[model samples]
Target: MLIEPLLEIRDVSKTFPQPRTLLEVLARQPKRTLHALRGVSLMLRPGETLGIVGESGCGKSTLGRCLAGLHTPEGGEILWRRQPLSDIRRADRSRRIQMVFQDPYSSLNPRMTIAQMLDEVLFVHAPSMSSAERRDRTDSLLQMVGLSPGLKNRLPHAFSGGQRQRISIARALALEPEVLVADEPVSALDVSVQAQIINLLESLREKLGISIIFIAHDLNVVRHISHRVAVMYLGQIVETAATETLFGNPQHPYTQALLSAIPVPDPDIRSLQVGVQGELPDPLSPPPGCGFSTRCPFVMDKCEKPIPEFFDSGGEHHVRCIRAHSSTFSVPA
Candidate 1:
């Protein structure tokens, strides 16, 4: 029997309106909405890391914010164990789903010490806890993220980028959340630091058994931790598959282009950056057809037509391309 997913996102869409400039406002221009997410759907299995990879402005961050309830969707549903996420009580939701933001410095309060921040979180989430228990728990959280309890009284400014991020991770886990939405948790750190944070997250996931939605533009980073990967383009998921299956044999044009760009170790077999022509279309007025059609190397006449639905490549892999059924559209060697 198949186990139900911890989170079910079905056709969730989020749009943000552009604030009118003085000239536009004076001219009485029509308000335009940026389609941050359009009919996005995916299943986040319990205790599995689902990596979301995409170009900048492709709605990866927006999707994370939507999952964390920072931005409410304009359409569709987000289900937590088959129950509507919106209906869950605020405090209950906070404990169940937590988000570790991209920038640790910005996410943490400079005025509050590390211990104070952790204590505040515990107080809010577990108000019935005794002061002694809270302190114990705070120290445990810091240690769990590989930080010293002595630094608990230190400000965020005193910590390195990686240390600060660990604190951010610790804060997110303070409530013992079942799901963690990590949005580029290590992107701002040094290369060495990125590896450290990634290992910490992997260890935490294994130990805590918490499902993670890891969003990052770095394919290598996503590949290291994700059980499955979803590729997004222009506010929609163009392809999704098991980690190895996607890297070994990507079907979608956008996904293929992305994977091809990864550098290889062999000098004779250097990575080829597939010249995917054109740039991402403006979300304010997206193309009528597939979002990646303009950049797709295998473009066809029908590709310009609106895609009403996605085509499944196999039971495990899914692709939004109309040519998903054709083998000729495979990425060049």
Candidate 2:
């Protein structure tokens, strides 16, 4: 039996126009556009966590924002259970999808107390509920995220980074959203705090049976929590597969480099050194073909031409490199 995807992104593209300088304006130069997402496509199955991993500025956050309806895409369509996302009413969409930002402190309102924050969401989504009902719901939300309901009266400023993030999670769950777009939710917290939040999210997913799009550059964290993983490069997803498959046998050169960079604690075992070469391509004017072509050690002449399509290596393992289409293609030692 085939289980349909709960959320589907098809050929999505987004661009941000740079502000024109006075000199450029006077010279009649066209405004530069940053290609944030380029024909990116993926699927999120019901009750599964999908990890999106990439270097900084690889459009991971942009994709998360798009999923949560924070930013409108310039091209392509996102479907929520086969229905176009744009066609869904704002109120209905808010109840189904929620976002947890990277910085807990910045995402919360300092003036609003923990109770007030959660109450606001409930008030908006469940206006029919009485004040008593809303308060009860608020208390439950706090407790659900492993927070004390007694701290509800305190403002966001009074809480630590991890506590603030718990509040954020509570607020996001106020409406009982079916999908959560967690955009580097633990990145700003301390190392110890990061693990706590990660465990919290993992537990919440199990308890609520909610789908999650976990976006982050922390490969280790993603590997621990994600059922599947997608590797992004220069605003495009270069590879995607089951978590173990991707980490064990990465097909793309970029993916291989990222995995090789992971720190191996064992001094006895020497890890491969496939570090990526050169800097990321400028977003304002990305390369014509494969985004990693400029830095790929095994780049062929064809990699500089027409962009490659995803080649399925096996069930659920897809790679965007032209070389992956050939059975014998392997990264040189």
Candidate 3:
């Protein structure tokens, strides 16, 4: 039997207007906008983690927002198990897609206590839950996320970044969502705290079988958590493969550059490596062809034209690069 993927996005697109000057904007025709995401297609299986890794301004966050319905795509389809998500009933939708944002300290309201926050979710998603049941579940959630019921009365200011993030996870899990969309969830925390949260998420996935779309700028952080990884660059996925395949034998130049940047922990090896070159290309009216062509070391003349279509890199592995499908370029030693 074919394993039916839980989430599917097809040709999703989002663009934002770029106005250089007030006079220019008013006098001339409407100018080009930042194409935050362009014709992006992807699939997520149930109870699996698909890591989205990219540098800043590469549209990783925008795609996360689109997947969680925080920002509707201007084009394309978002489907959950073959059914269009846009057509999902509101009540079901609430219990289906949940988001855990970065900066938990800011995501919470200063006025609401932990109990109140969890209660609100219960009220919206499970109103049938009695006050006693809601209170009971609140405690359960706190414990589940490694927080304490004793701290339930405290405000956001009382907890450290890690603790606050735990609360955020508790709240996201409150409705027992089928899919958790996390956007830079650990980027704002200390390294130790980041590890704890990552561990917690992995444990929860095992225990609850909830699917996760984990988005982060650091591929190293996602290395342990993701089953499959998709590398994004300037509004498109340059390569996608299993975690082992991606890290060990990357196909796309962008993916290779990203891997090369991962700092070697050993001091002796640190001095030997190089990094990706050039500043990120302007997203507004992105270049005619492969966006990374401007910086790619092995870019061919074909790269200056329209990007080659996604090419197969064997079973379940895909890469979008002329070099990827061409017989000419060999993997660097």
Give the clashing residue pairs of candidate 2, or none.
none
lDDT of 2 by residue, 148-188 (tens): 89999999999999999998899899899999999999999
Q: List residue ranges in candidate 1 displaced over 4 A.
A: 265-273, 327-333
* Model 1 worst lDDT window (10 residues): 266-275
Pairs that collide in candidate 1 are: none
Off by over 4 Å in 3: 26-29, 264-275
lDDT of 3 by residue, 29-144 (tens): 66768899988989999999999999899998899888777788898899989999889986787688899999998899989999999999898789798999999999999999
lDDT of each: 0.90, 0.91, 0.88
Ordered from best to worst TM-score, the candidate numbers read 2, 1, 3
What is the lDDT, from 0 to 100, of the residue 32 in candidate 3?
A: 65
Q: Model 3, poorest ten-residue lDDT window?
A: 266-275
Candidate 2, 276: how far from true, in Å? 1.0
Per-residue lDDT of 1-333 in model 1, one digit per residue for the tens? 667999999999999999989999999999989999999999998999999999999999999988888899999999999999999998888899899988999999999999999999999889999999999999999999999999999999999999999999999999999999999988999999999999999999999999999999999999999999999999999999999988877778788788768876754333333667877789999988888888888788888988637777776799898787666655445
- Candidate 2 overall lDDT versus native: 0.91
**Top candidate by lDDT:** 2
